[model samples]
Target chain A: MNYPWPDIGTPLDQVATPMPVIDEDRLAANIARAQDYLDSHGKAFRPHIKTHKIAAIAHRQVEAGAIGINCQKVTEAEVFAAAGFDDILITYNILGAAKLARLKALNGRVPKLSVVADSETTVNGLDATFDADRPLTVLVECDTGGRRCGVQTPDAAAALAQRIAAAPGLRFAGLLTYPAAGGAAEVEAFIVGTMALLAEQGIDCPVRSNGGSPDLFSAHLVPSATEHRAGTYVYNDRSMVRAGHCTADDLAMHILATVVSRPAPDRAVLDCGSKALTSDLLGFTDYGAIEGYEGARIVSLSEEHAVVDLGGCAAGFPGIGAMVKVVPNHTCVVTNLFDRMVFHRDGIVTRVETVDARGTVW
Target chain B: MNYPWPDIGTPLDQVATPMPVIDEDRLAANIARAQDYLDSHGKAFRPHIKTHKIAAIAHRQVEAGAIGINCQKVTEAEVFAAAGFDDILITYNILGAAKLARLKALNGRVPKLSVVADSETTVNGLDATFDADRPLTVLVECDTGGRRCGVQTPDAAAALAQRIAAAPGLRFAGLLTYPAAGGAAEVEAFIVGTMALLAEQGIDCPVRSNGGSPDLFSAHLVPSATEHRAGTYVYNDRSMVRAGHCTADDLAMHILATVVSRPAPDRAVLDCGSKALTSDLLGFTDYGAIEGYEGARIVSLSEEHAVVDLGGCAAGFPGIGAMVKVVPNHTCVVTNLFDRMVFHRDGIVTRVETVDARGTVW
Candidate 1:
């Protein structure tokens, strides 16, 4: 696509630098790379739509050979499923009556509807909402390393899988794992130990799904992994850079914000603040990644302005009328902040895509 | 206006309870109360549009005796100004070349255009952007206890005001203060002292703007104040409640979320998270105000779900299916996150007002 801001030029005195800017080139390449990996590995690449939360990106993934999209929330799945994606796997434990009702409703529209369950309560909630005829496929989540939510051990896993199989409105699929950072060994140990036990019990184990972007490369190390779902790899951000996955230039999303104020000698402000980049440092040292600028801490943030304190230490301030590029600590949350993001290429902003699920909130 | 969801009944099952909830009765009372105060006060009420950023609320404000609306960013002002609010005071220092081009364009459309300047660079940036025929009015920001911006002394204020008045594309309108919490005396001292110094310089100061919801009641103490602009009174969040300005029930904006997971005993996860509530604690202790549950420390927040640890919990959680309301810690940031917030009347969702100025990043 032809870019709109082709004439913007290279930093002619900062036009407006606080809002995020999306680098379309890196994003396309990342999607292609992930697709290539999926193709070679004989594994289904069901990318999670939560990271982008934009239907445009989802459509792009489907075009890039993604089997489907994985959603962290039922509401998110509802959003993507509504956006014409035929298949979606809800990765989180889908509990509660209202959510189950929504999930049961979602099953008819979506070609494939699968969910992960860790405990009996969640399965019970799912059972109450779903019908026996339209049984929901259950993936037993094993707590390999990352201890957010899952059955603690292989025995706990087997018990849950058994419960799922025995349940009227449920069908046990297989083991699932959201791998711990670099804990491929743990994932391997858990899946190997559990599947063998299940085989001894004469239970069939077909699907083995795992996800999370931090250790996307480690998926190959995880034996018996039938599929992998990752989100952040598509639009690598500052967090990805911090995680040693991508470079700052490789980042696809840039908050195209304006430097609104220069409050003091060494102080500059961007129209983008916590509302734009968000204070989700995501375990990073710096507030966000501003490609060229260094020694600038995004010290203060109101709803609209991000006050950058240069500490009177810059070689020279980028003048008051400068447009600055800011990489949010957490790109996904920042994307959620805005209703639409202006897509730019070759120094021009041409298309503005609506974050249709911008604030679905429920 | 009719409400959505349950009016009165047993709490929702499997829901993450004590989330952000809007109290309809108190919300109406807050609007009327703030409107009444602004109406009765001598100063013109240009209730800051940054609070809600909703045109419906702006329309409501216009209906409720607001002379104009004070918006911090150009896009925010554009929303109300485009909606036919003839007068608008964009309080932030609108810097940058492209933004200036946009601001210059805006100056022609809006009948009255005013902005703030706390630095010399900003004054000049404004000078470069505006036209000579219709110079933009500059409000010299005074450091009234909020040490973020503004001139330190009255002489400094007089000097900048004189410079702004002398600048080709700028005219010093008056003084502005976003005071520290309960810094009315500081506003009074700065105004009186600055006015005295300006008089010594034989300069006429036209606008004296004092703002802040925490210090809204004390605004009358600044006798020469021309206007008062406050945003947070629209949604009296947990921070406001802690500031003693509002009770918990006075909150308006609530996150309508469902419980997705019940991982363990005394732990449930709600759909609303940092992407919704935002990380702006505003110095208030708890994450966000959960009406009936005071002890529920919003222990964890991801992009999409708020993991509330009800371990040493007080009020029991609502059921999984319940749609609980959450009074966010900082309402302003919360407003910036979502595209639309469903207004409720008597617990029923009434209207889906567009956040017209949303994602107007640059």
Candidate 2:
């Protein structure tokens, strides 16, 4: 599997198509902007590495003033930990013996490790794997209208936090919520109610984590949050653009695809399909947005072909062998599709980095 | 990145969840049935390797009477060629210099290599890459109705065939079409009209390749077809079952996921998210079908969480830490999401094969 790696300064057309190309300038601007916003709000920014899944990018984020990295799985956190990141927070209910063992090993390797638990079973699992010698911080995840993966009410969150504190080897860290976008007030209320219950139980809550890239700018509105976690804000996508979180110029990642087939006047197919661009619609009507083709719409996708309807384009469709850049609907899922991505500066290849934490879902 | 590979005879519960498992018996039956259908129709079966992307399974298809394997990309074909497969058909309009060079090298390694071309640019590109000493066969792709990638009309198909025949170092093999399923009449008419036009130009059409998994059993209805290509029929999925192509019992691939969180009585989230199960809707209302949970529907997916509404289950909802099997909406795309899959017999692990061409999309 010897792929053709482009030269240090080779242009994009000279390289391969249907591959991810990260704009270095755009990446730096995005990182600085997000960090600046959080810093001005007097909150800690713990960026989620699950979006980029690259150790180099994670290191850069940390160097740019990120407090730590947030991972959704133990294996993903392990990759960043092995890459020399000392502080990590895994935001999932990790279960099973195989994973618990890995979590224990990861806890030993990192100086600070935090996990989330919304149920008693998950708290017990974490307690069984760790002890006072190697304490593991557990955060109670509250469902603030996200309708997924969290306790239903504030009372449930306080109860879980109390259980974590009662269990040996487990320290109740704080409250975390991945609330629905535009639900900042709900998150604030949820955090306040949960902290009140914790106060009555004589428990001290140190951290309040609120996360979502869509409402990142409004994070300050939630007064109870001390830390914010986000992944997609680093590389805004078509969904982010539509949500008004970022504009097209802020998109750092794009799929460089060649127009391989022009079957008819209205139809042109690109080499990038589900395997390259991903199928996460993310509420977008189309799969992606072509840079210059304002009117073009990606109608459908097979396993290896992305069929674009060129009838809507104001400019004529591209000819065969012409390369085009596509902004995928979801950047995080697109990052997981490829094993490696090329970072470019002004269309010149600079470096190629592997997605180290990709496919480590367990 | 050392993953936990289950030992031989390891139970499903002992292995990590959210991984693909292939049932050996069902796989064998699927292969036998599809091959039998094509054999009885007097058509050569060239199973597409894009579905499984494993050399071991491609070898089994060849052993079960497949003439060759159909690949969607040159890099994918190279993986099969390195694994001792000599005859291959890459059903993509390969463009760009980097890819053409790789194609030439692959042609030199394989005894028989054919590709599809619907435009003159593709034909000339193929001609420029090889000479008469190392000729390449080209198939004129006809747009019968699939509307993805092919020449618009039979006249265009014949014209492209004529151009391919006149080009040096290229031989016009025959006519090919990836028509809409149940489009036997359209395929027959397109092939007949193209053959008539080619005959007027004093040309011979040797192979007529018709492909689709849904209408595989109806392949014989199109008498002009000499060969049929299909990939998903070997590992039927939710889409195939909904298409009336196969039953749930015919499905051979299933994702083994663990119920990691029970946020509420009506909602249970599995570890298999879009990263593991894929977000390919494929016209299905739900993401996947949970075995024995007749009423359950996968409501949504995050990067590491598959939130399923468990209110519809006839059987009781799976408790936290419970292992469940899920049949994905599109099995082929789901196969590309994983690096390796476990093969099992009667719930016992037998072999674990890497998806050799998993991300070889050039």
Candidate 3:
């Protein structure tokens, strides 16, 4: 039942292929760089742990001056809270009786636990499960151009805040918006308008939370935001590089896949595929970027094989059994694909961390 | 840590949302149907365990008369083999020293274990790891219009078979082809020609393997195929339905998701997203099909939310907290998403099984 990892000083060729690897140096640099940016901007940085799902990395972020951690699901937050991340924000509309009960239990355990809700049903569920003695803090999620989940307008946000404040077991804490990339102006306007409406209703909006990794730097533009939340900054990816957020050097995680089959000169198949790297294109045409193979692109992915077309490569491609590092299109999704991830320092194994919160989607 | 599911006979509304559920009767019917087709065709059936990844379901398939199981990776096969699946065919080119050693160990433990390779590198690795004392059987993967992994021509397949035959610790079993759907003609021509070529060289070809759920019925067209491998048919999905292989009633698995946010009249965001339903569109534009909402189309997906466009629904859509079942575009990828799947018979929970090979990509 034990899965083996290469020893610390073992060569890359000796390590397992199609395994997720994190460059320790690059990871430290990415974490420090992100924290520095938020510190200089005077924003409370709450890095989403959904990116890595590894407690060790989350602990590193906390040590690097992160104010809190953000999780997408209640079960995911439980993993972090159990690992001593006291302040956590579950940025999703949690419903269902079982989940609400779990959330209330998690809220009691964590020192600071906040949840976002765009509708009254979510608010009511939280209120029904939590007690007035240990009131749950609820944030009204706003549709600031995200067009996914949220109250449609600033007015709706204010209305939701009123309901949260009136609920016996809930406290209206803030206005939260996960805006679309480059939608800072809209986020600012929406939050400012909602806060004004809440103020008129004698409700104070203490936290104005805004997020989106693609718009991480431009977060300062939204002055109404008291804190900022973003994931994927801790381990930049191909989508981030294409979004001009970071360069290839900033990518800390890669799927170390070996060329298992070179059936023809043009076609070489890697052991990593949708099951290993994930199928989230995130606006990218190719599945991932093969490091050192400049022109080579991952043409397609089946469940367990990434078929790469070597026709586009200007330089020579790796032969069979030769390992290649693939920067996934979206790094966060790839983290959820595996049960454990290997950490490396200059191609040498450092640690193998279990993805503790993986499959915590419920 | 305890994820509660609704007890037997409990209403569907009471079960946790965003969970994968299986209809026991439908699953049994699907399995029996596929087995019957292969039985009538006089071909040995090898159901791929990658679709369900549950040991119990795999055992049922074997009990229903499957000759063996098909796994995509060595680690995946290990999970099945350890779970009492004595015969297995790993239809992948497994490389790396660690994996080769594991494969050899697994081969010794299992009564019948076979692997496929389309290149000399894979064959050499298998030959080096295994010995004449425990000789390994290898099938030459044929392209057969799949354009993913396989030797190009019959001559190449013949040459590879000759190489495998001459190897010190390898046995040339036959040919394997994961052909493009509806490409039975190509598979037949390639296999028959390769068998003829092998015959001219005094090499006997025992097994001609052709696969894919879409072409399962048409497998009889390939007269040279001794055994057929398929995965998705046991839990028929949207892709299989769209491919004209089955109907909605045949689908056994569905992602049970609750409407968490009704942000607008046209949009309803479900708790399930790419993390639950998967992003494997499998040529389908939408993420999944909501069972009763005929016009509803999954507009987009983030990590934690499935933004469903309710504009198309002729039947009234459910309000927030109301649960709905979603048929994922690709069931295999969806199976890899969740750790446990709930099985039900007559709307009553029967059992909850862990996805034994959920993250066995390596």
What tens-digit string does per-residue lDDT give for candidate 2 at B74-147? 88999899999988999989887788899998999999999999899998899898799888998998889999
After superposition, the stretches of candidate 3 with alpha carbons farther than 4 Å from their true spots are B5-10
Candidate 1 residue-wise lDDT, A288-318, digit = tens: 7555776777776776667778884465656
Question: Taking the true A–B contacts (Cα pairs closer than 8 Å), what share appears in each candidate?
Answer: 0.47, 0.83, 0.81
Relative to the unseen true structure, what is the C-alpha lDDT of residue A355 in candidate 1, on a scale of 0 to 100?
A: 71
| Model 1 segments more than 4 A misplaced | A1-17, A33-43, A95-102, A128-134, A167-169, A180-182, A345-351, B1-21, B35-41, B124-135, B167-171, B221-224, B284-286, B350-352
lDDT pick, better of 1 and 2: 2
Give the local distance difference test score of model 2: 0.89
Whole-model Cα lDDT of every candidate shown, in order:
0.73, 0.89, 0.88
TM-score per model over all chains: 0.88, 0.99, 0.98
For residue B213, model 1's alpha carbon misses the true position, in angstroms, by 1.6
Of 2 and 3, the candidate ahead on lDDT is 2
Candidate 2 residue lDDT tens string, A20-76: 889999999999999999999999999999889999998888998999999998878
Error of 1 at B90 (Å): 0.6
lDDT of 3 by residue, A1-362 (tens): 54656677776657777888899999999999888988999998899988999999999999999988999998899888889988999999988778888888898899999999999888888878887899998999988888898898888998889999998899889988888843778888888888889889999999999897887888789998989898998898999998899988899998888888888778888989899888998887889999888688898999888989889873499898898989999988988988888888988888788899998887
lDDT of 1: 0.73
